[model samples]
Target: MIKKLKLIDSKFNIENKVGMLTFCRNDIRNALTGSCIINDIINTVEYINKNNTVSVLIITGEGKVFSSGGNIKEMLKKNTSFSGPVEEVEKKYRYGIQQIPLYMEKIEIPTIAAINGPAVGAGFDLACMCDFRIMSNNAFLAESFIDLGIIPGDGGAFFLQRLIGYQKAAELTLTGRKVSASEALELGLILKKVDPNQLLQEAKKFANEIAKKPKNTIRYTKRLLKMGAKLPLKEFLDFCALLQGISHNHKEHKSALKNIKRKM
Candidate 1:
């Protein structure tokens, strides 16, 4: 059975084996640092990983902004996550907002970012963490941390470079420029762009497509893809062979074979 998640700053629902998490703190523009969004995200990812019934996850914001990243007001006041000494700040980061990326990386299911509006700083990094990004044509993304005299304290550099290569990632990071959705598609940063009204529908459609696949195979394939990025070719193939053996022995594999034979 799939477990119900108690998210403090977000809303979650499941349908057709696809779980959707919407950032609900539009009052603060879904800022990660000041609000409970980081905890919500980490918790949601953890829940999805353990829930075998869920095959894909779609994340988006509820209002005009996807996420404004950190709360600038809190930063100026040196309150909340931005408060305290250098050591204190480091500890906050290590245990607080930084947990999102760590948990996201370990998720076994496929993830999609439905960028409903501007995704700035850590917000952009959040989208980059997903396996796929479907953005609204009216929305934009920015690596705006440079403007604040800070860097991506949430592992943005690591994911961005892998998504769009180092040169493009460096240009965006150093310049802190806003990238339109169309431009993001051209740069290979986002998979597709749709009208604002169609963003969630399109994202759900994409999610459902992946969700329709054989359950265990989807998780295993996602794991293999992540391993492929860093594992040596021989090691990857060895792992793949092991998974293939397990997959072939599963009942789903037999059912799939029977279906194929019937069609033939």
Candidate 2:
């Protein structure tokens, strides 16, 4: 178990290959700033990745808010005398906002973003990076980066377009729209929406369903999905065909086929 430095005791539950990460930062609506989230996200992801015990991870916020984006108060104070005259602070930590999304995207294990409330800017991008998202009926997504006079530093452009289409993605990014839960569901931005009170429970149910599957198949599928974005159709097909051989020999795959034959 990796010890996370700044969290409130890492109080979460896990069983049968499903882990829950509750955002403990009750302050600032669970803002994932450099100091507050660096160790936490790293530890959470590492714990899930290391333990094959956990096949899926679910993330939710403490109260009504999922995340309020990066600490804008902290960000805007960079050049101010109150922020101190350290150039490294701005250069290093300003860039650190990019890391959380990078880590989220690189996770081999499946992830579920349980959007309990508003997820804006960095928060929205983080949710977008997840394998799937289930939002509360009261929850909303805010692509507020451009509204804040900044371009999204994360892989927002890449994943957003893939989730929705290019035109819709562009509209969201350019207009900095506050997309409601129902609209997000209708547009396929999220898997579904549950009542605010049942958000976490719904997320747990969703994750448990996915966690019951063969892990290797999920990982391979995620890889192909990522690869698909970068490769031509023929090349992607070739790669997938080559990759299928390993799964063809995998024990879970063999067992599934054998069980089907028995049933027949």
Candidate 3:
């Protein structure tokens, strides 16, 4: 049995094999920096990877704003994670908020970002790190690092381009423009768009759909999808065969087959 997760800046819960993580720092618009949100997110991701009972994760903010990215107050004050010399700041990036993308990449379960409000700078990148994104009609996204005279130091460039292609990603990143839900849907950046009140409900509905599948099969399929993006065709197929062999012998597979025979 898995113990409950303790998070300082977020709320985490699991229901029906679906995990939901909500950013609780609404005061600073759920800023990634200058708060415990980063650790909360990384810890949650790590926990989910070890928790076989969870097959899907849904991330969102508790309040109106999903996340405002880095804390502007901290940036201006040059304190917290944004403090110190140039090299020190680089180290902070390596050891700090950058961990979100790195950890998120390794998660075995499917992740969905329920964008209830604006997700700017690293917040937008955070959403991109998820496998799927569902946005509220009133919400928006922005690659606003450029406007702050900084670049996407948290792997935003890597994930965003993969989501919407390099050209469009470049345009958004360079311009530092806010993308409306409609425009984001048109660009295929978001999988679905709904009213604000329905955002979480929609995300849960989708997450539950994935969670109800054979647990190990869901994880293996997610792994295959992740590998397919980087691995060569031959190597990918080889890995697939290995997993398939194991899957065929699992009790879940036998039960499924029996059910199919009954239906027939």
Candidate 4:
């Protein structure tokens, strides 16, 4: 079922194997408007989670940029000056935009962000939502929230600090600097960078490899990581101990144990 969210034009391309969800408006570098697209992302992800068919999701951009962040012009038109504009957009952003990343954060299936080009602002937050990221060499990540005289929303502070480390994430967010693909990979902000022409191919290859892993194990691992930020270490250890026991009894674990015995 093509979940209806207007800003996104779903192709249903590559179907159950992997869903290639791209931003449809490339004219403005596929920037997200504060409307249906964000809701669409939430709807699409939830739909995928319920469907047994879609094993992985590959999210990419349209023409040049992944997303130029949230719609700046829309925000500007709402309020011409300082804190007023911030409050005007903030309510819409929090309600309409944040859910996309939140859904992504809790998603069971592995998500691959194919950074076809530069991603800034909320776009950067969107990229950070993915389980793995494969970027184009031309792709850059910008923390533009500060430049706009606003703090990073759409999960900027939450994900960046985790990705690169507190001090580094602080510097980037505080400075509103644009980090290159090479620098991002080096800092552990991203997994790898591919040439622009090869970006999608690399993402698919990575997704396919993940798709081959035992599904429940992957889901459990992702769940644990999601809990990482929220749980105390002792509690986390207890949770993992229980989860690992469940995993051990799973058939894939049993099969792997059998294979190991045969090798011995």
Candidate 5:
């Protein structure tokens, strides 16, 4: 049986502030249930958002599969997880697993997904939600919800399209095909592919490079990128001006300018 989700606080090269969330249910390939959604993912992101000391968050699974997504046994039995009439089921989705992405959006820190193995169904969407992704050479991704007679319920439609474009997202979702690690890189879905044993190590190194920069600037830059992606050009420029004002006044910015002058 699966036990629990584990949160780890680690540093890379003694500089980066990193927080890791591991899916500890190795026995079942970290198949997600209602409890894991509420107690593990959503709750953990809440804490990570509050912890200003952490500049980056990395998510991974303990075993060969990143996650199997939903519990098949629960679906078969019409278990409380997905049970009830149509309206009730709709409400369950709105109030349940949907909260994961909603909370994930609120996090100011950058998130990196270290895919150590295959990520299927909603698991694929979960990795897409991250700001960056690195995969194990042995890993792959499958939008396998079509096989279950269901659609992407956990924001995969939105996330996947934004990452890999409409054509590729449609093909993956409709066909339920697996995209290998090399293909993921070629398709611009992941950053790098490494051996399974080095997945976390490389991810930490990547996170450290990002974390070494000004923390507040990194957070604000991420916020700007998200807003810019959806906002009108004029509105995005206005938003950038406002954030730039704040960034210019930050101590880190001031320190960097002073160092530049000294070198000059």
Candidate 6:
């Protein structure tokens, strides 16, 4: 078992192959900055990637907020994370908080974000980075960088457009409004919205269902999905055919087919 993390609580269930990570910085609504927690997130993702027993990762926040995104106070004071000159600030962003999205993009394990409360600004972008999102009915989300007189610095513009399409992404990012859970569902931003009390339970249940599938198949399927997002139709279809051939030869696929035949 891996040791518990400081800024994040990591729980792994070996029997079910599920890993849950809770962001514990409720003091500032889990606000993010160009701080050590960026490394913490990268390290956690790397740890989960290396653990073969863990096929899924669940991310949530403690208390009433998932994350407030960037530390606005720091920006206002031009201190702590935002004190440097323009060139220095650019480097800081490149080497610090930027690593989270870059590292998270590589994890092959299925990642789910269980949004327990308000996810604003970069916080909402973090959730978008995950493969899936499950929100508490009481939770809300906002691409609120515009409200702060800034832009989506952490890939919100790109990620949100991919998730919900360009027009809607434009509306949210441009308006910088808080979107309620029901509106999020209507926009196809989340998979499900359950009661706050049932958020983690429902997310874990879904993770377990996915984890029960053959691990290699899940990984390959996830890869294909990522590829499908980036590749042209013809190129994606070619890659899909090749991956399907490999999947057909997998022992897990063979066993599943055999069971189906036996039942028939």
RMSD (Cα, Å) for all candidates, in order, is 1.1, 3.2, 1.0, 3.3, 4.3, 2.5
- The alpha-carbon root-mean-square deviation between model 6 and the true structure, to one decimal in Å, is 2.5
Question: For model 3, how does the per-residue alpha-carbon lDDT over 133-246 read when each residue is reduced to its tens digit?
Answer: 999999999999999999999999999999889999999999999899999999999999999999999999999999998999999999999999999999999999999999
Structure candidate 1, residue pairs in collision:
none
In candidate 2, what are the lDDT values of residues 1-264, reduced to their tens digit? 654333552346687778787787766778877335655776677666666667888888888888876777777665531255557545554556666777786777888999999999878988998889999998899888888787776657877888899999999999998999999999999999999888878888878788888887877777788789899999999989977988898998998898899999
- Would you estimate the TM-scores of all the predictions? 0.97, 0.85, 0.98, 0.85, 0.91, 0.90
- Candidate 5's residue-wise lDDT over 122-144, tens digit each? 88889999999999999899999
User: How many collisions per candidate?
Assistant: 0, 0, 0, 0, 0, 0
Clash pairs for candidate 4: none
The CA lDDT of each predicted structure is 0.93, 0.79, 0.94, 0.79, 0.82, 0.84
Clashing pairs in 6: none
Order the candidates by lDDT, highest first.
Answer: 3, 1, 6, 5, 2, 4
List candidate 3 stretches off by more than 4 Å.
none
User: How far does residue 75 in candidate 4 sit from its true spot (Å)?
Assistant: 1.7
Candidate 4 lDDT tens digits, 28-129: 667766334565677777777776456788988778889887777666674431225556756766666677777887678888889998899888888888
Residue-wise C-alpha lDDT for candidate 1, range 1-264, written one tens digit per residue: 666799999999999999999999999998887888998988888888788888999999989999999999989884578889999999999999889899999999999999999999999999999999999999999999999999999999999999999999999999999999989999999999999999999999999988999999999999999999989999999999999999999998999999999999
Alpha-carbon shift of residue 173 in model 2 (angstroms): 2.6
Model 1 alpha-carbon miss at residue 41, Å: 0.9
| lDDT for position 190 in model 2 | 96
Q: Which digits, one per residue and each the tens of the lDDT, describe model 6 over residues 59-91?
A: 888799998889777787755666688888778
Candidate 1 lDDT score at position 229: 98
Q: Largest lDDT belongs to which candidate?
A: 3
Point out where model 5 deviates above 4 Å.
Answer: 1-15
Report the Cα lDDT for candidate 5: 0.82
